[model samples]
Target chain A: MSKTILIVGGGLAGTIVANGICRQMGAELRSGALNITMLGTSETHMYQPGLLYIPFGRMREAELFRDQRKVLDKRVNFFVDPAKAIDVEKNQVTTEAGRTFKYDYMVLATGSRIMPQTIPGMKEGGHWFYDLDGARKLRTALNEFKGGKIVINVNAPHKCPVAPLEVAFMLHDYLKAKGLWDKAELTYTYPIGRLHALEPVAHWAKPEFEKLGIKYETFFNTESVDPQAKTIKSMEGSELPYDLLITIPPHQGAQVIDDSGLGKGGWVPTNTKTLHREGSANVFVVGDTTNIPISKAGSTAHFEADVTIDNLVSLCQENTFAREYDGKVFCFVETGLGSGTYVWFNYTTPPNPGPPSQMIHWFKLAYNRLYWLSARGLL
Target chain B: MAERQKIDARGAFCPGPLMELIAALKLASIGDEVDVWSSDKGSASDIPAWCAKVGHSVVEASEHDGYWSVVVRKAK
Candidate 1:
């Protein structure tokens, strides 16, 4: 009998998995040995990393969005609906539109979202560059910013950990080009004591931060923001004043995962190596939705997709899953002036940071275009 | 000498130069060669990898002052 595979959240993770399966099991899929369906919230897939360049006026907003249908494989069926709940025992999923799907196997790729309101006074007082709207608003605020104190505060475990640092580096160059560096007091305040979660990255970045004259304040866990007063109070009661506040807010998993009792603390719990949800044999999870310590990044999702698909294919043929993910994560950090650094790491090895160079910057630019091709299994 | 067209993609970011090369290839006749000049560093390997994937032939790829130029021919 043919097995029905239902994939939730047709973003990068889900789309890549679907394409990978289609490429590997074309004959089996064509012979009615397997069927695939992908459910997503919308047809537009945003190239999120491009958001980093928006505030600098380097990339246009329109260039970041693509029709998800065009990027997905034709062999897979696509739908636009929010997943409402998962009935693990019954092997079924319920959508917000009163539709339910029965699956022999399921893949969870619903990514996380930023919750700015979680912080007191943050929704009203702070600006961020994580989203398109926020980037647009920050662009206007940055253009009007004539000098004074500029703060890039990170509130929680935000997606793409390197972004805040990249913004700081870019802002440094941007201000210098505008002749406002002399008057601007630039500061980067993070909740953690280290500049980066990875020690090697911190070591690599320390000198660059000093060279740019950016004040690095560690253990500045923001407790509240006094927007009208233009100040932020840390949990330990220290206060820092700012002329403009760009903050990365806290993140949470999809509400449906929590509603289904498949997650705790707004994150789905899964075996870090197996990519399977705890206590579920037929269901698997990947991407930012999982409670993993690695960076919640698209590169993580891309790597996870490979292992998940391999295991799923194995389960179909051998009645067991053998593939294991090693927590490999890769990222390119843009360091302004058309140059950037690359970091590669996994569970066993510490991140090896490469020096900032223009060549790596071009690779990042190439990866953005290659991502679309990758979605369709063309690259 | 065979007719060779030059595409000036210098200063353009990655895939920008490659996309321009692809578009130019679409308009060129079979056996016509197109030379692409790009300042983006990935163009050196990316262009050749793309050519290999799609069955095009790379004539010559050379480094110049702060840029790289790749020559490709429509093979099929």
Candidate 2:
């Protein structure tokens, strides 16, 4: 009997998992002993990290996308179908097109999405860069601005933990380059009491922010935005007025997750070490959809995908599981257009961000291009 | 004499080189040495630290040209 692996979500994690598995299980696939299939919403894959550069005009729109088919292995069966429901009890996934896929093993990589609508008035009063349309609109908003109070409001449980700070720093440099640094007042608000969830990063950013004269407000959970008044109200009873409001709105897992009764808020309960969907031996979770208390960055997804591939290969070929996933995450943070730094940590270790340098900035840019290779499991 | 294996991982980014080193070390004899050539700046510190934590020894680590060559010997 052939082993079938059904992967949901065609984003970074699913693609990587499919390609990585194919890289090792080619003989089995050719012999018809194994089948790897992926269900995705679109045929095009977007490099999400590139969204950070979009609002600032740092990257061309063409550079962020590639046809998903070209990136995946030729042996894998790829479908441009979205998963509508997941039945873990029966080990089957039903797609939006009314097709049900049964599998020996299943991978849930149905990443997260922003829920600006969850907050009152946020949909109308605020601008975001988490998606392509939002980034383009924000670009236009930045271009037309003469300069005034700019509030960068950050919400919790968003992917890419450092992006809010990265955008703030980049915006500072962007304003400076446009000769509007003095004309604009930048203020950042976070839901937490600290500048960052990571204490060390909060310490690192505080000095950098102070040096740039960027102001910040902590413990400000977003309650609503009043476009009519050009003000944002926080649940803590603080209201901030802005000429322009850029926000990192809170995120939730894909609606299919909640609809399928898999998890609340679209997040699947997953074992942190094993990457297994809680209580489902053959079901694994990866990427933003998993309810792991870690930074939901692409690197985290990539690392998790790598471990899934290893264990799946062992299970398919040897009838035994392989290594456990070390809770690992890495992220490159840009201090400005020219300088950047990175942090890497596992379950046992905390990240200590190094000093910013231009070389690291170059590496980040290079990685932006090198991401395709990484997705193919070649790097 | 301990057998030595060479890995040229200069162009790969962080974790890439380190992952390759770990894979190589797994296939190596207990007394064998693995020399990794990595251009990633983090490898300088990450390789040595990973070696120490995992009970491997860093036989030599030095910079040459644009990359650094770190040598590790499997202990167990």
Candidate 3:
């Protein structure tokens, strides 16, 4: 009998694993083997990078999206319902719509969620571009805007490590195009000392901000936002008033993960190299849900997918897990005035910081096309 | 009726050469050609494909020293 594989989350990491499994299964199925099931809540798959473009008027929300269900290959059974609980001991998953599926091996690809309106007054005043709904909300707010202090703050550990910077630079471009450049005071605030966790990137990014005349406020860990008064206060008592508050809220893994006792707080604790869930040999994690100390971005997801699939194949064949995932994160930071930068880090407990390059920007711009082609199984 | 701008994008990766070419095209004259030198294995085929799709003209492309120089004329 063929072993069953149940995958949760049809996002970047999940999709890659499913497609790879199908390719492997194709060869196996010819010899007769392999059963796979994939579950997701929505049919639409979003191009997350485009959310930064939406606020800047560079790309439309409609153009930056695709049907997720159609995107997946037909070999794996796709379900358009969210996975609510995973009975790890029994190897079954309960969906939000009240259906259960069993499997021999399970993979968690459930991505992270932004806590925006969860903060008081955010729904009433603060704006964001984290999700499709958040992007839409921010768009409506931008359309009616004049000009004042524009504050973009990071809540920290969010998906797409470079996103906060991308949004900030795009906003700079948007305002300059509208002739509101001088009228606007753009401030980018982060809890960390640098623009990004990677010190070299922070070193490079700080100078660019100086050239752009945009203010960079570091070490201001945001406690909360008093949107009614249009003021954002940090834990240090420093406050910045904004006409438009573009905030990136705190992110955590899926709630279902916590409910299943598979996660603590919001993240699934796992071996960074093995991706094996703590104490469970048959379960693995890929993407933002892992408690790996790296940027939870799509590239990382793609990289992790490669590792997870390899390990899964090894276990199935009763082979020792040989490949260890080195936390490799790549990001494209957009700098306004028609330029961007690329940054990569090879995490080894103490990560080795790679130098920033103009090539990184071109690489990122090119990634859009590469990703499209890659998703189609063309590359 | 002018000399085309030259872009030495040799030894660059997939989209690097392409993006440099696109960025240069924004500054070039209507009839001026922009030459891109790329050593990447993918760029030799990609440049011509991009020109065909976007209505640009490919003047000349040749292999040189672990790289290829693909010249593009801005048609529109």
Candidate 4:
């Protein structure tokens, strides 16, 4: 009998793991050695980073969503249900509809959630562009919005760290193209200093904002939003009003990870070099849901899959887990007007350094097409 | 006498060579010329295409042992 491997979540990282396992285990399955099952709640998949470009009228809503079943192979059994519980001790996962599954190996790719309801009046007043639904709502809001104070409020630890800055720059470009630059005031409010995570990279963005006349609010760790008052209060007790508020929602791990009795501090803690979930030898995690000290982006997930697949295959074969995946991430940050900034980092050593260049913009565009092709099993 | 700038983009990727040339052109005078060496397979075609679109003068474009050298003159 073939040993069963179960994977949960179907986001960017989850799909990558699903595809990786399918590609590797297909070889074994053809020879009668393995069985795999991939589980995810949604049959449709969404390209998340495209959310940043949605508000600027760069990408359409229909372009971001695709049927998940069209991408994966027909060999692996697919489950279109949410994983509500996990029994790591028993090597089983339970779905929301009371379906129970048992596996010899389980991979957690259960990405993340954006918590806007957590903030006061945020769900009602502030518009977020973190997910497909959120992007659609923000697109509608942006389409109707006339010249006024447009605020991009960033909550802590959001996915795709550069998205807020991209939104800001794109909005600046959009308004300028509309001849509404003088009529609209674009403001960016972030909890962190500068625009990006890297200091040197951040230095390049400040001038872009200044040149575009976009206002910036540093150290503005938002506390709550008062929809009726049209105000957002900072953790430091400052308040700002906006004509339209676009926010990147606060993120948290999937409910199953938090309830699995495995995650620490609401996120799966893992070794930096090994994506093995802490306190569990048979379980692995990839993507934003892990509490890794790196930017939670798609590139990080792609690199993590390289490690997780190696470790999972080794463990499955009873071989020694010998590979150490140094955390490496690369991404392109859009700077409006067909311009972009590329940032890459390798966190193998102390004070991980980020190398930046403009070529990354084209790289990002090309990679987007590559991702689509890969997901469709065409590459 | 004429001033010339040499940019070695042999190890870089697609838009990298183009961005390098653009950044260099910003610091050079109108008549100053830049020679870019790129190993990216697409650079040979992309550099010339970019020069055409942006109205820059292409002095010379040739393939070397393993890299391509494209000379661009700032037209504006």
Write candidate 2's Cα lDDT for A1-379 as tens digits: 9999999999999999999999999899999999999999998999999999998999999999999999999988999989998999998998999999999999999999998997898989999999999999999999998889999998765888889999999999999999999999999997655687666788999988999999999767677899999999876578999999999988888999999998767888888788999899999999998866667889999999999999999999999989998888899999999999998887667678899999999999999999999899998
- Per-candidate TM-scores read 0.82, 0.83, 0.78, 0.79
- Candidate 4 stretches greater than 4 Å from native: A349-360, A376-379, B1-76
Q: Which ten residues in a row have the lowest lDDT in candidate 4 chain A?
A: A348-357
TM-score of chain B of 3: 0.89
Give the C-alpha miss distance for residue A68 in model 2, angstroms: 0.3
Off by over 4 Å in 3: A30-32, A349-363, A376-379, B1-76
Per-prediction DockQ comes to: 0.01, 0.01, 0.01, 0.01
User: After superposing the true interface residues, what Cα RMSD does each candidate give?
Assistant: 21.7, 16.6, 18.7, 17.2
Steric clash count of candidate 1: 0
DockQ of 4: 0.01
For A1-379, candidate 1 gives per-residue lDDT tens digits of 9998899998788888898888888887999999999989998999888888888898888889999888887888888988898888999988989899999999999998887887789888999988889999999999999989988997565678788888998899999999999999988986544576556777777788898899888656677888999998876457899999999887777888878888743567688789888788888888888866567888889899989888888888778776799888888988885899888777666577878899988988888778787667566
- Root mean square deviation (Cα) for candidate 4: 16.4
Per-residue lDDT of model 2, residues B1-76, tens digit only: 7898777766532224565565456446899998998776767887787676557899999999998999999896
The candidate, 1 or 3, that scores higher on lDDT is 1
lDDT of candidate 4 over A36-59, digit per residue (tens): 788898888888777777767777
Per-residue error for B7 in candidate 3, Å, reads 48
True contacts kept of each: 0.00, 0.00, 0.00, 0.00
Docking class of 4: incorrect
Give the 10-residue window scoring lowest on summed lDDT in candidate 3 chain A. A347-356
